[model samples]
Target: MTTRNVRFVGGPLDGRVQDLRDHEAVAGRLLKHIHLHDGPKIETQYELHYTPENGWVYFLCGTQP
Candidate 1:
């Protein structure tokens, strides 16, 4: 098994990157937070990138129209 890095781009959190063992947990928490602030209808995407060595990588969802 491998670990993953998180990266965000083209949004409010652009250029932000994070290294976490439980990125999925982090992502879930973030999504919940956004839902509370932005509501369930918010437009965004959470992108995940997979690596054989480092692990899964992801780009945090940036709100969009």
Candidate 2:
């Protein structure tokens, strides 16, 4: 058996915007902008995860197209 642990570098964004919906909205906008500027398609599937301890959200994996 093998075990592995991973630690994230950044913490949650604490300020005026503290709601999950707000966060999702912001992320959605960012993704839309990225796609528009970069391209219409992405080669890899990007995973976004949220945690209470970590704060808002973070990306699990990503690859450049």
Error of 2 at 1 (Å): 47
Tell me the lDDT of candidate 1. Answer: 0.51
Off by more than 4 A, model 1: 1-4, 22-43, 51-56, 60-65
Model 2 ranges with Cα > 4 A deviation: 1-46
TM-score, structure 2 vs. true: 0.28
lDDT tens per residue, model 1, 1-65: 44546655444455667765653634233431133355445555566655567444455656654
Q: How displaced is residue 60 in candidate 1, in Å? A: 6.3
User: What's the CA error at residue 22 for candidate 1, in Å?
Assistant: 4.9
**lDDT at 43, model 1:** 56
Query: What TM-scores do the predictions have?
Result: 0.37, 0.28
